[model samples]
Target: MMKAKTRKPKAKSKGKETPKQIAKKLEGIGDGMVADIKKGKDPSFKTQLRGRSNVEFDEDRGILTLGDKETTRNFLNIGHARKFMQTTMVAAKTRDYLNQNKTASIREVYYELKHTVPNSKENTFDGQTESDAVIVDLEHSVNTIREKLNLHANPKGTLYGDITLKDKMHHNDKFNCAKLGRGGWSVMSRLEPEEIEIVSVNAKYVLVIETEAMYERLVEEQFAKKNHCILVSTGGQAARGTRRLINRLNSEKKLPVIVFTDGDPYGWYIYSVIKQGSMALAAHSQYLACPEAQYVGMTLHDVETYGLENVTERMKDGDIKRAKEMLEYPWFKNKLWQNQLKKAIREKIRIEQQALANKSLEFVATEYLPKKIKEKDFLP
Candidate 1:
């Protein structure tokens, strides 16, 4: 029987930032500039240039690691000139936001800074994409995510579980995913560790689902209670909040994480993002990536094992391209992953998690899950 599920503690958000800490961070940027001037050195801000060259697949850790190649965006260099100015400006603005205890989205940041630069004719930012990239740069430089700077992405995921959360956004009134009628907590917002308190976590493992339909079906069936696990769904690509929550569970709550997705390149990439960290946000890997998480999937072999070939669909061009790229990455160079990719490319077929629908909605919970868990058939 499902245990009586209820959120016990009152939830309250704490520590977006106090005035003192925010002021200090803002002042530090100014001080760094002043010291550079005093030392007769060019005022510069150093940050890692984020790209393929800077990111490498770590075979041992099974994650993408950032390289030590650094770029000093100084007021003197031709290229570094504008970036240096932008860095300080963004830092100052972020500190201001934190000091005010106000939050903004990536889009909001672009609008706020979209005015013409004081000295230069070009507007602060021509597009949201530009500001978004700058926010990532800020994250890399400051060793903090944009959320702490009071900036958030449009939320994109949901979670359901026996675990309870005390959010800083809420008044610390505790809430559990199981109690949320349906939909649980819409995790579109960022999951800042300092902001959310995991008041209670009786669940044993975290089951991350890629499809919303599957997540809903499982929730309807009371799968979390039946299996003693938390269910999370990232509508498509798992967002930062979803990924961060998984990391916290693995690192702090010590909950084993199992990722369930379709048997395709896209599904594989989703699993990669959860386990090894996203290449775009590689700088925040430690906070966002759950390296210990395992992929318990709809692997290509599952096509035969579950007798799902008829339900499989043909692979698309984009799918083939992505699979090729993943094949080159060292983190996925292992024989198991290589064989799966090769099978997909050669067969030109991909399976969706939904295909298992033929077997019945509860087929995943009642059949796939138990067998995978018992056999330890997770993709490492």
Candidate 2:
């Protein structure tokens, strides 16, 4: 009997993978499965299982990461066959999209691939959820993001700053965020370096706000101009694009990131997701998480110091429950957060970023932020 030759997987690129690269990786998976079948082996592949149990927070790196808990999905296994088939279908569709230089939403991919299996009554996909899960599986299997495969989620978040951006993949136009009027530049879902270029930055720091209302207030007050900083609004929780932009501005442009959010457990969780990574997306934390980011406001301590106690809202059961749960998180186990959570749970109260309006609309942009930054008063 002759020994079979073994092949090592190719090394992935440092940042974003090109469409060609993505297509090659997709093909590699198919080829590997074919090779396995020909070699009299199970046609199977492994993917890191994702969930709370499989996520670990790296103390040194200050980011969440997926642990080495991989599960093999075999084409011959009944439990894994549906998902394996779905995953391959998604990969095939994604490769077609890449070859044609076309982009589609995850929803579009689901619809495009939805059909009744040949000689079978079962549908390839019952809904978008099944297809969406398989897309993520294919991403993990290929060691690349869906964006690289010519797919994207809905775009969210906004940015207003004295920065210029070049859209190399689309318009090939250079535009300044400052001149975009009050609406600001809509942060697109695909901000991969190859797609969008951060041409120039003339800012000192980046202010990531949790809400759009606060973002608009800062823009209206010319906060970015006066402070010489960038204003990024995550809408609510920071999306992958917003987080990646924040990471790029901090790491590449040498700008410090400060997050401002409502003084509630949910809002603080948003800040945590920005500064640290979330369990769901831990695999891409190095690309999306800004661990160096600081939290600068809406702290429970701020209510009394700033005389905004009257505006504080009573904490609901959910808020109190969340606050307690956060205390157990390794990242949130610091002295500052310890005091904040204990106080919030004890006091049964929460506050919003908008509560600062009691002082004045410009107070946050002018007084609060400047004082905090100057004193280096930020929670870890």
Candidate 3:
């Protein structure tokens, strides 16, 4: 019985091999098996049982799976795979530099890496291979890293560097006239809104005229006495100083503003500046343009409606061309421009605010300003 009680056969250790390990061993044994198969030698029974049919062979499926799938492919055998890895490492280092410098470009990264690699090979991979495959792989890796890290491409080459929307807003707030006064006017120099003096403020409304000539005429004509609104002249294009002053008037004084301008494109753009900041500049959009201000104008329609046909001047070819081009602009293609352009095409004329001066100081002072104030329609 003791002799029969031999140690129970050692339990077979069913330790399972990982897919990666299995793949490696299969790859190692595959070359010899494939050579044997090529030589027309029948695989041994044991090899056959083990499913070894050829070198570098796939047992589960006959399909070749090598040098393609990134996760499975060996970097040494596949040029693209090796390049991809190298590019990834370079991109990581570049990203680190970008985090510190914040103004690195693709070209800069390429040159920097090229300098670090031996022989200063600009296009070649490790100075041995000349293939765009590596550069392409590097670009792909950089893009992937950018997506994963939520990093923005530094395309602008800005001085403060790659800034976010929040950064822009923060910078805008710092430069705000309300915060820094007219002394910080440099920030808003780009907007170019008219400058007007805050002559008086009662409560009802704010009146802004486009040109200084109009302001002088209104004052000389005694229009200020009739209309109780605060009068200010956006002294042409609304300069930086003017914008700062307007900001103070609107925010601190809390006055609802109305713009009076000529019916031409330039005047329309000026009125737009007071209402919805100018598009030409980038920084002053948020601070200078008051979204709430309304436009009250000397429009093309007023030329006909007011029986001022004699005052209407012939439209220049330049004016017509500009009007047509306005159709392509986002804001100008609306009903406002459509009506204006149709009138311009039909009448073949353009009207200026100065033409309204002929209506006599009494007519303009009494009828014109009152009608605009009541109707709340900025454009004629």
Q: What would the TM-score be for candidate 3 when compared with the true structure? A: 0.46
Q: Judging by TM-score against the true structure, name the best candidate.
A: 2
lDDT of 2 by residue, 249-296 (tens): 987898999999999999999999998788778777777888999999
Better of 2 and 3 by TM-score: 2
Q: Is candidate 1 or candidate 3 better by lDDT?
A: 1
**Local distance difference test values of all predictions, in order:** 0.80, 0.87, 0.47
Error of 1 at 159 (Å): 0.9
TM-score of each: 0.90, 0.94, 0.46
RMSD list, candidates in order: 7.6, 5.8, 23.9
Residues 357-380 of candidate 1 have per-residue lDDT tens digits of 778888887888878987889888
Off by over 4 Å in 3: 1-200
**How many clashing residue pairs are found in candidate 3?**
14
Local lDDT at 121 for model 3: 44
